[model samples]
Target chain A: MNALGNAFSLLAGGERETWWTIATSLRFSLWSTVFAVIPGVPLGAALFLGRFKGKRVAVAMVNAIMAVPTVVVGLFVYSFISRSGPLGSLNMLYAPAGVIAGQALLAFPLVTAMSYTGLQKLDPRYNETLLTLGARPWRRMIAIIREGRFVIVQAVLAGFGRVTGEVGVSMMLGGNIRWYTRTMTTTIALDAGKGEFERALSLGIVLLGVALSINFLSHLAVRDAR
Target chain B: MHADAVRNDAVRNDAVRNDAVRNAPAFSVSRLTFRYERKVAVSCDSLEIHRGETVAFTGSNGSGKTTMLKLLNGLLGPYDGRIDFLGLPLARNPLLRDRSVFVHQHPVLFSGTVKDNFEYALRLKRVRGAEAAKRIAMTVERFSIGPLLEREAGRLSGGETQRVAVARAVAAGADVILLDEPTSSMDSASGSAIRAFLLELRRSGTTLVFSTHDASLVLDLAGRSVRFESGRVVDEPSTGGTL
Candidate 1:
């Protein structure tokens, strides 16, 4: 208990390096969410609207991707970004950019799956009125998106939460480089490994605070969207 | 003028307009059929609607009255049949949709003001600038819904929403307005307002094809009444029909 109290002092001490790690983690998570949502929204909306063959198969594939372990995702991305791999020429290995890319990949499934489920629940009356009013094809699609926007925002929040909590992908692809790629999750793991239980516990508390903040903000947004 | 004199004046006016459309049916259908998977939704052997006609399709729920209105407005294509609209083959003509609008039974308002909803329809029909503004004002006045013009349209009462739906249809300059239970959601006052506006539309030569279970609406607005039962038109020869 004394050690935990000391850790709290260390955290509350406002050290510049610790704050930098916090900032870096948040920046990477934000970028990851931004990238995932771009392609994810259109892809998810199309998955709902497009009536081609293999639709069930495509949806199943998305659900399967959502179940994949984060460690496996890390390993798969590491292979491509490693020095001897095909994409190594870009020299992104052991960099924050690689972490962002890996985290974006992790968040993509959450964004897409939630969006698809959200739009699937839309009322059929929206489409019916638009079509009967002689709305052009593009206008009808835009109307559909607008109608499903609340669910889509929730999808985005879920992606943000997932990326912010992820440890495996950020640690593996980012290589935990000190003062550069070291993030909140990676520092927590490092502190625990070195038997620095106090720092680990304090950082875990910080992570918990951040996660709660995100969920609280999302709840407010959900109410507003409603 | 006396009420009977006004009725005779309308009849005479209809005759004069009929002369211009003497050769062509407003809509002609033969052996029309529609199916939803294994269930037949609509089936009719033959039907024709003359120009400037006001018709009502009356039946119980799921009796294919709404299905028939949808087929007429080209919102749903017939599984097997030929439909001629305004002297053109409906299947090949892309302009048929431009000439008609269907107000849904439960109207879904766009996410904006009442003015915006009416403007969207006018814009789609390529009416713009001063012309579009004029049309919007005309519709608002015609429906006596000037008070609801600035409010969020989706938050309106059921009757107000239907009024806006019909107004938007008119703003598009559609020659034919197909309404699927436009007044089923309204109170008596709102219903009478809708009927009066519909009569105003008829005077301007806009044909109205509506579906309703309201016997009074059919008696008041429709010159022809088509009755449906079990997904089939049971009215023929001696029953309700257009002459």
Candidate 2:
């Protein structure tokens, strides 16, 4: 009970460390979401529109990737970005860039798979109408993306939430350096291990709040879709 | 003597235009066959739709009326035979899409205002500026759809959606329209409105290939009727002109 009160007080008081941690988490999640969405949405649209050979296999591969653990994604990214690795000269290890890359990787398949599944539910007439109206391939893709905006919005929110709540990539790549790369999830992990429940609980409350907000927005998107 | 020369010149031009229309069919399909997975959806030995002809496709459900309409408009392909548009092969004909359009049984509008839908179709044809606006205005007034111009397309009723769909296609300069049951699932008022619209299109010399179960529609507007049964052309009489 006392720990919970202190946690809220810490948040209410706007402690510098807590606020900074929240900002770092949000910044990393936002950039990663942007990076993931840039290529993911189009790829998903292609998977939905194209009728080439092996399309089923490609879709299954994306779905499989979406289920992969975040820790595994972090480890995979670490291999290329670590010192003495192929991309070692770039020196991305234990850096914000490294964490952002890892998180983006984690969210890429999520965004793609979600967007594809969402678009699959669209009425078939939309595509036929676009084709009959003489919309070229690229233009058709843009139109479809616009038509499926509700589903795409949900996919984006899911990506942001996935990256923001994950501690594996941030801890592994960002090194959880205080005043540098410390994020809410990583900070909570460290403080909890040291029996410092106040900060951990505070960050947990914030994470819960974020999760609730995302869920609320996702619900609204679905209602709008119907 | 001057008036007599002008009359002769006009007669010569009409003969030339008629010859051109006869030589170039809107769609010439030969031995076309389309399959969905393992099931054949459409099989026709030979078919031709001429310019300014109103042809009706009469078939029961799953009888390939919709599929044939789609095939005519180049919406479905990789079939077993050849299809030509305007005497040119489908792939080589640059103007095929520009001159042809298809409307589904339950038409779907884009995710914006009816005005936006018009603009999108016109933009696809590269029609912009005052020309596009002029076309929209003319179509809106013609179809009595001015009240629907700013309404969200998804919020429209079935009849309104169909009107907007056909209007959008015509405004974009389609001379050949392949419609899949344009009047199905409509109230009497909506059906009458759509039938009136189709009559107007016929009067304007637009080529229309439509699927229908309504025999009265065929009797009223079709110059020629083709029947389909189990994906095969059971009967197709010789082509005739509505003119």
Q: Say which candidate scores most in TM-score.
A: 2
The parts of candidate 2 lying over 4 Å away from their true place are A86-91, B1-22, B238-243
Candidate 2, residue A95: how far the Cα is off, in Å? 2.3
lDDT of 1 by residue, B178-241 (tens): 8899789689988888888888988888878899989888877788888899899865332343
Runs off by more than 4 Å, candidate 1? A1-10, A82-86, A217-226, B1-26, B74-78, B82-93, B125-128, B235-243
Interface RMSD of each: 1.5, 0.6
- Cα RMSDs, all models: 8.3, 6.8
Q: Model 2, residue B125: displacement in angstroms?
A: 1.0
Task: After the best TM-score superposition of candidate 2, give how far the Cα of residue A141 lies from its true spot, in angstroms.
Answer: 1.0
User: What clash pairs does model 1 have?
Assistant: none
Cα DockQ of the candidate 1 complex: 0.39
Q: Chain A only: TM-score of every candidate?
A: 0.91, 0.98
Residue-wise lDDT of candidate 2 within B1-243, one digit each (tens)? 122332458675455434544697887889888998968999988888788889999978999998888877778877888887766567534566788999999999988899999999999999998999999999998888899999999999999999999999999999899888988999989998899889899999999999998877888889999999999986578445433
Task: Locate the minimum summed-lDDT window of 10 residues in model 1 chain A.
Answer: A135-144
Specify the poorest-scoring 10-residue window by lDDT in model 1 chain B: B234-243
